[model samples]
Target: MSVLPLVFTSGWASGINAYAVVLLLGVFGATGLTDEVPASLQRTDVLIVAAVLFLCEAVADKIPYVDTVWDTAHTVIRPVAGGVVGALLAGQSGSLSDITAGVVGGSTALASHFVKAGTRMAVNTSPEPFSNIVLSTAEDLGVAGIVTFAVFHPTAAAIIAAVLLATGLAVLVFLWSRIRRFLRRRAQRREEKRLADGGRIPGRAGPPPW
Candidate 1:
């Protein structure tokens, strides 16, 4: 059977999000977007992942073009999450089950991550460094929580993950809007400065115009 439903329903991931982190990267261990998940809202492990990803995204924004750069680098890291999840599931089953779970989980995570990353790149310009960072930190916290709760409260893990993921996404959208406004204002100021400097005129008697 699929540990995914187990993981997803068992406080691992939500539906679409389940496909991203738990199914692709965490399950398959691949390193491509075709193997990741969408950036959509999630309720389980996917939510936790969203939080982590949001942080990664924030870091990427801080570095100018590093958002894309982070996306590229994460190809490797994405699958690793899948592997970890698979290993966890396999422990509950037999040896063969573990290996299978690893592959499937990694694959799912990859697909989900790819979709999420692609969407973010397509929509935004530059990056909102601080907001993304906060988003990512939230994700890290969610992941840690899931791991801790998997033993005692599997279902709660899913609920917690969903809550964390949704919160991150909402925060991201909010930050995105604010950042855009800030950038536009900054651009306007720069342009005005340029125009003012260029328009400076000197008296004919003067030798040089500053």
Candidate 2:
């Protein structure tokens, strides 16, 4: 969907160009600092795209004001774009089709933006001005690339666009597992300490005092 639109607006050539930039940054930008996604996906092109998007987000997010600002700007742009594209492409598909397209597109775009925004909060450990500006500029270029290429060369662009969508899902799954483990450990410790201190339930004690 994203690649299709990007190709539509940018010219097919622009779409491919956009896809390449995202792939380069996403696949090789960083390793574990963000998420540990493979450079390429198995079957889905979106996985590769998500990897790049995630990587681009990871890099942009590390900056203080940069990531926040970029997300804010895109919130309005990404969704409307999604809606417009959906409406146009779903010709004769009726209102439901447009609505469905809008919903899916908007959701995907918002999630991608959210991950990018959230990462910056943790990455602001380095207060370097140059790095911040560089990252922000790169992201700006990424958006432009997608927008430009959406019209000219959709097939190539579509393949590139698919990479990021899948990567985001992988990143979320990885984060969720880590969080679940942490919570479980924390709960077990609390339970152990409570039992050691005889903090058992007054009425539900073992054997019921029989």
- Leading candidate by lDDT: 1
Write the residue-wise lDDT of candidate 2 on 52-126 in tens digits: 665665565546656555556556655554444444334322433556555545555555555444433333334
What TM-score does candidate 2 reach? 0.43
List, residue by residue over 1-210, the lDDT tens digit for candidate 1. 334444442223321232233433332222332222222222346556655765554455344335545656776676665555555656654433656666655665565455444434433453555544454454444444454454345456556655644664565565666446645765898889868666555544533356
- 10 residues in a row with least lDDT, candidate 1: 33-42
Backbone collision count in every prediction? 50, 33
Tell me the TM-score of each prediction against the true structure.
0.43, 0.43
Off by over 4 Å in 1: 1-64, 92-96, 119-127, 159-210
Query: What is the Cα root-mean-square deviation between model 2 and the actual structure?
Result: 15.4
Give lDDT: candidate 2, residue 20.
34
Identify the runs in model 2 with alpha carbons over 4 angstroms from their true place. Answer: 1-63, 66-81, 88-96, 168-210
